[model samples]
Target: MAKRSIYARELVNLMAGHWVARAVYAAARLGVADLLEAGPQHVEVLAKKANAHEGALYRLLRALASVGVFTETEPNTFSMTPKAELLCSDHPNSLRPLVLLWNELEYSAWDDIVHSIKTGECAFEYRTGSPFFDVLEKDMESARIFREAMAGASRLIPLAISEVYDFSGCNTIVDVGGSHGNLVSTILSTHPDLKGVIFDLPNVVESVKNKMGDEASRCEFAGGDFFESVPGGGDLYILSRIIHDWDDEHSIKILKNCRNAMGSDGKLLLVEIIIDTNNESSFGNWLDLHMLVMQGGSERTEAEYRRLLDAAGFELTRIIPTGQWQNIIEAVPASI
Candidate 1:
């Protein structure tokens, strides 16, 4: 066999990943994984169920099968792979929403990446004439998908948090900017003795309340704005994946709210991805760019977190790794 050139092969593989992502996105949109859940199905049946063209659907399935997302069990028939299982909408760890969400949010924004890089402005905003979050607000469909996508992606984080952190001695946990109370619910479920407050916009508060059900017995839904103020009298405050959505000024403002809401000896725990200084292939590295393009925010290094927390009237205590994508950042009021 003729030896292939390693350099060209690697570069083409990199380019092929772009095609694979698009193929995966199409599969997700067409509900392919869910359709294949029972057993293997021929393209003719899948296309009809999915309201897609049979020939095109077959080609898409073939491409995905080559990459292990699905398997071409026999000619014209396909079955799900472990990778494809993540696309099943009913799966607890489903990434289908994320794929759909990327199609709505990131895919087009990524097309005009040059503009964001050139002007230091959000590509989503520049292209759509609205900020990323604003788009979520105006477009009801976008908002729902965004919520589901984030909730699905962070589903395990709550379990990780409950397991890794010691909740002893803390009576109340305030999940600032927490949506649907999943994290708060997990903590409250773990530490039955502790009470929880779900703080967010009025609409989100209602959603959280609706979702909490029996858990509401030990939880309070505080419907308000974090930019102005937060609910007080909490033993500990949790700001999970919140600070990274804003620039330093807004981040500090939210941190200060937590600081003000804190009692003496109160601690702040922020769930975020801690970025390292050195260059490496990391999710944080990819997210840093996503933050840059969608919002003017960036993932922070330890030094950056320390500085941000210090300016917000707290001292960075330590960072706890959950052996997952996110780490727990602990801080305390400086005076204490």
Candidate 2:
């Protein structure tokens, strides 16, 4: 009975887990890890550099150190740990942008999760009185941060996709909605003979032109809406994290567009989280809630994916699990 009581208490603590998330967000926002990049610093020194209250900074550092984000060398001095290093923007696999994105704006949207549950609408739009992307479009800083957050969160998944998936024997691989062209760049680097196309909106393709650099030489930047049409003649089309943002009807439209664009022997790859059955502990389950709150989309099961692909005039061939958060759902045109 005592152990049962302890377990129940632990569950309650987990329910309030966002407190620590907000604390870490505050640390990332203030660039605490970056400040410690030079060396260990006293809390007062960090507070001065970050323009925060010294005592409050010390308290924050103490709590974070308890969680292994940093190490307290002395009464007020703190040093970065490997975990804290991830919050530094200079780190190669830094999650700084994602942490920053989870700050006040995300919190405000999440606070209205109840409203989303009640109305089957976006909690963000309900709270902010506008769509999340519309607000992002108006605010350049917010838009930049959101993009960086997405890229940062995609860190290992692109490399994992490039490495695990066989891209051989394909003339052209079209990355639909390939923002920043990271995945295609990784793929092109591995498959030398494969020409790649980054297909997205005009502004999206333009924004990442300079970012593509040498990859731009071997890749074509085609600007258009995937729902309307995609560039033709590509044997393989990669739709990474694109379909989950929409409802079933809209998802079908985008998939149908891919089907229309793909030739008889062409393939369509969807990279998304595949929710498992009766698994309350799966990350995808919680992410499904996040999706429900942020938009009306939800993480899908393998069967659900098959139904969607069939409805979009495609046949689901296989589902490959990647080393990252996503699973690759491969399909071909039904006629094939």
lDDT of each: 0.88, 0.86
Give the clashing residue pairs of candidate 2, or none: none
Q: After superposition, how far is residue 197 of candidate 2 from its true place, in Å?
A: 1.3
> Per-residue lDDT of 128-236 in model 1, one digit per residue for the tens?
7887776765666777787788888899999999999999999999999888578988888878899999998776676557767566899988988898999999989
Error of 2 at 97 (Å): 0.7
Q: Relative to the unseen true structure, what is the C-alpha lDDT of residue 85 in candidate 1, on a scale of 0 to 100?
A: 97
Model 2, which residues run further than 4 Å from truth?
none
lDDT of 2 at 238: 96
Per-residue lDDT for 46-141 in model 2, tens only?
Answer: 999999999999988898898899999988999999999999998877899888777855677888888888888888878888876567657767
Model 2's alpha-carbon lDDT is 0.86
